[model samples]
Structures are given as C-alpha cells and as structure tokens.
Target chain A: EDQVTQSPEALRLQEGESSSLNCSYTVSGLRGLFWYRQDPGKGPEFLFTLYSAGEEKEKERLKATLTKKESFLHITAPKPEDSATYLCAVQAYGDVTSYDKVIFGPGTSLSVIP
Target chain B: DAMVIQNPRYQVTQFGKPVTLSCSQTLNHNVMYWYQQKSSQAPKLLFHYYDKDFNNEADTPDNFQSRRPNTSFCFLDIRSPGLGDAAMYLCATSRGRTSHNEQFFGPGTRLTVL
Candidate 1:
C-alpha cells in the first residue's frame, strides 16, 4: 500500500526562524511528490513538485528537496503570512491506463508568531 | 481571479438531507477531483473525472456521487448526508490525467450537518 507520513504534527516558530518539515512515503513506484500550503478554512495551494531524488525547487522563502523515500520542505526566515498547514502528497506508478491515486500526508500545522 | 471556483463557500444541511456542491474551472484542465477534509486531517480523495470519464475511489461511500456534464463543470452530491459527512469539500483540477500533474485547487466548501 502506498502511504505518506509527515513529522512534527505542529510547530510554533518565531518570526524569521528557519525550520524544515519532513515527509516520508512508501510506494511501489514513485511518480511524483508534491508540496502544498493550506490556510485554515481554505483549499490547498500548489507549492512544488519533485520527480526524482536530489531534485530541489524553491519559491520565495520556501525550498523543497526530494530523495528516494522522503522529502523535506524548508522554510527560511518565516513570516506570519507563511503560517499554514503544509501538506505532502505522493503519486505512485499504478495502472498506466487509469489515473493513479495521490496519497496525502496528514500535514504539518505551522504557526509563525510575529 | 480564481481559476478554479467552488460555489456556496459555506453550506448547511439537515441530517439525511441531500445536497449538491458546485465547482467550475476556467483552466480547462483534463481532470477534476473532489476531496473531503476534516479539521487537522489530510484531504481525502472521493473521486475524480478525466475529461468525461468518472473514476471512483474504492472506499468511497455509496451516499456520495458526482457528475461532470462538461469539461468545465463538476458537481458533488451527497445523498442522505450524515453528521459525519460534515467537512470541507475541495475541488481541484489538473492539466492531465496522470497523477504526476500538479493540481490547482479552489477555495473549498465547508459543509455543516445539523
């Protein structure tokens, strides 16, 4: 079974504090790993997609890195506006003829106190 | 402007009553997805549409149904909604049928069951 797990269920950070969130997965064959930011009572916003190990992508103060079994989302100099639930989702190579399922982690709730 | 849109950002329903949530996307993506999310939990995929073809998840309840009459619109219908069915329903779209594609999400509809 393909599954995703994220670490540090909740984190409280001071403004400008830097931290990293971990996401680990178990899949038969990896297709892609995705990162998303979801504010309370809102939908998730797309962040980054990592397809292979050693792949890295960055946007503003956020950086995402992927490996064989895990992915990390690093936040640099966080701001209160950046506080939200970070979600990690993984896609596995299932039946090629049909659309595969994307497994999502429970997400890490981060609070940036300014 | 929101590329993906969900109507009735907040919905209220009585127990065992049927309700429909609407979603429309201007992106004209090839795939649309419906997900259910609860507080502090991951968004759970209920089903998705690849063009006009509907794919239902194995664990989805029979009380939940969906329809995609055209490429731009989709609807999620809950038949006999229960208290447990109260959740945030998210609508998303992707440019392709493959799971590797990044999905664009709309502000979700929060359902309240009485």
Candidate 2:
C-alpha cells in the first residue's frame, strides 16, 4: 500500500528559528512529491513539486529537498507569518487508464512565537 | 489570477439532510478533485473529474456523489449527512495528469452536521 508519513506532529519555535519537517513515503512508482502550507480554517496553498530524487526547490524562506524514500522541508529564519501546517503529499504511477492516486500525510503543525 | 473557488465557506446541515457544495475554477484545468478533511488529519480523496469523466475512490461511500456540469464547475452532493461527515470539503484543480502538475486548492467549505 502507498503511504505517506510526516514526523514531529507539532513544533513550536521562536521567531527567526530554523527548523526542518520530514515526509517519508512508500509507493510503487514515485511520480511526484508535493508540499503545501495550510492556515487554520482555510485550504492548502501549493508550495513545490519534486519529481525525482536529489531534486530541490526553494522559495523565499522555505526549501524542499527530495530523496528516494523521504523529503525534507527546511525553513530558514522562519517568521510568525510562516507558522502554518505544512503538508506533504505523494503521487504514484498507477494503471495508466485509471486515475492517478495522490496520497497525503497528516501535516506537521508549526508555531512561530514572536 | 487563475484560481479555484469554493462556495459557502461554512455550511450547517441536519443529520440525514442532503447538502450540496459547489466549486468553480478560473484556471481552465481539465481535472478537478474533491477531498474530505477532518480536523488534524490529511485530506482524503472522495472523487475527481477528468474532463467529463468521473472517477470515484473505492472507499468513498455511495452517499457521496459528484457532478461536473462543465469545465469550470463541479458539485459535491451528500445524500445523507451524518455527524461523522462533518469536515472540511476541499476543491482542487490541475491542468492534466502530468507528474509535474501541481494541484491548486480553493478555500475549503467547513461542514457542520447537527
């Protein structure tokens, strides 16, 4: 079965702290890995998509790196605005004629205290 | 900006009552998805529409039904609401079934069953 797991269910850090969240997956054929940031009472916002191992993507203060079995979302000098639930998802290659399956992990909730 | 949009940011319905939630997208994407997200849990795929074709997840209950009237609009109909069915219903859209395509989500609808 394809599964995605995220560690450190909740994290609290002071403003300007740096931290990393982990996402591990088991799938038949890895097609894509996605990262999203969701604020409370709202939907997730798309962050990055990594397609292969060793692939990395970065935004202003967030960087995502992918590996064969895991991915890491590193936050650099995270501010209070960066406090949100970070979600990791994986898409697997399924039967071509069938719908591709995307599995999501229980998100890691991060809090930045000012 | 091209984006996904959902109606009724919050909904309340009585148990066993039928409810319908609507979503529309301006991205002109060919694929649309509906997911159920409970508090502190990952979003679970209920179904998706690839153009005019509907694909339902095997685990999805029969009470959950969806309709795609056109490229930009889709609706999720719950025939009978249960207390357990209270959750956030998220709508998402993607261009196509490409490994690199990132799904864009709308502000979800929070459903409260009473």
Candidate 3:
C-alpha cells in the first residue's frame, strides 16, 4: 500500500525562524511528489513538484528537496505570512484500477508567531 | 487568468438535508476532482471525473455523488449531510489524468452542518 506521512504535526516558530518539515512516503513507483500551502478557510495552493531523487525547487522563502523515500520542505527566514498548513502529496504509477491517484499526507501546521 | 473556480465560499445546511456544491474551470482541463478536508487533516478524495468518466474512491460513501455536465463545470451533491460532514469541500483540476500533471485548486467551500 502507498502511504505518505509528515513529521511534527504542529510547529510553532518565531518570526524569521528557519526549520524543515519532513514528508516520508511508501509507493509502488513514484511519479511525482507535490507540496502545497493551505491557509485557513481556503483550499490548498500549489507550491512545488519534485520528480526524482535529489531534485529541488525553491520559491521566495521556501525550498523543497526530494529523495528516494522522502521529501523535505525547508523554510528560510519564515515570516508570519508563511504560517499555514503544508501538504505533501504523491502520484504513483498505480495499478490497473487507477493510474492518476494522488495520495496526500496529513499535513504540517505551522504557526509563525510575530 | 485560467483557474479553477468554486462557488459558495461558505455553506450552512441542516443535518440530513441535501446540498450541492459547484465548481467550474477556465483552464480547459480534462479532469475535475472533489475532495473533503477536515480540520488539521489532509484533503480526502471523494471522487473525480476524467472527461465525463466518473471514478469513485473505494471508501467513498454512497450519499456523495458528482456530475460533470461539460468540460468546464462539475457539481458535488451530498444527499444527506451529517454533522460529521461539515468540512471544506475543495475543487481541483488538472490538464489531464496523467502522472505528471499538477492540480490547480479553487478557494474551496466550507460547509457547516447545523
């Protein structure tokens, strides 16, 4: 069975703090790994997509790195605006029933206190 | 801008009442999906339409149903919403039902059961 898990279900960081969130997964065949940012009362916003081990992508203050069995989202100098739930999802080359199912992790809730 | 659009940013319904949530996309995508997200949890897949080919998840309840009238519009109907059904209903779209296609999401409809 394919599964995705994230560490530190909730994190409270002061403004400008730097930390990392972990996303570990077990899949039959990894096709893509995705990261999304979701705010309260809103749907998730697309962030980064990592396709292979050693692949990384970065935005303003966020960087995502992928590995064979896990992925990491590193936040650099995070601000209060960066406070949101971060979600990790994986799409694998599934069995005959479905090929495009995207499995999502429980997500990490981050609170950047000012 | 090409985007996924969901209506009724917030909805309040009585328990055991039927309600419908709607979504439309201008991205001209071939896939539309409905997800149920509770507080501090990952968005759970309810069902999806891959160009009119409806696919339901194995664990989805029978009270939930969906319809895709055209390439751009989709609807999710809950026959009898329970208090446990109060959640954020998210609508998402992808270019195609492929492993590499990333999903774009709408702001989501936050359902409140009374």
Which numbered prediction scores highest in TM-score against the true structure?
2
lDDT of 1 by residue, A11-104 (tens): 9999999999999999988989999999999999999999999999999999999999999999999999999999999988778565566899
Separate DockQ for every predicted complex: 0.88, 0.83, 0.85
lDDT of 2 by residue, B37-91 (tens): 9999999999999899899999999999999999999999999999999999999
lDDT per residue as tens, model 3, B1-114: 998899999999999999999999999999899999998889999999989899999999999999999999999999999999999999999887775468899999999999
User: DockQ winner among the candidates?
Assistant: 1
TM per candidate comes to: 0.97, 0.98, 0.97
Candidate 3 wrongly placed segments (more than 4 Å): none
Order the candidates by lDDT, highest first — what do you get? 2, 1, 3
What residue runs in model 1 are displaced by over 4 Å at the alpha carbon?
Answer: A96-98
- Computed on C-alpha atoms, the DockQ of candidate 2 is 0.83
Model 3: residue A9 alpha-carbon error in angstroms: 0.6
Give lDDT tens digits, candidate 2, residues A1-114. 999999899999999989999999999989899999999999999999999999999999999999999999999999999999999999998785765789999999999999
lDDT by residue (A29-70, candidate 3, tens digit) is 998999999988888999999999999999999999999999
Query: What is the Å distance of residue A41 in model 2 from its true position?
Result: 0.6
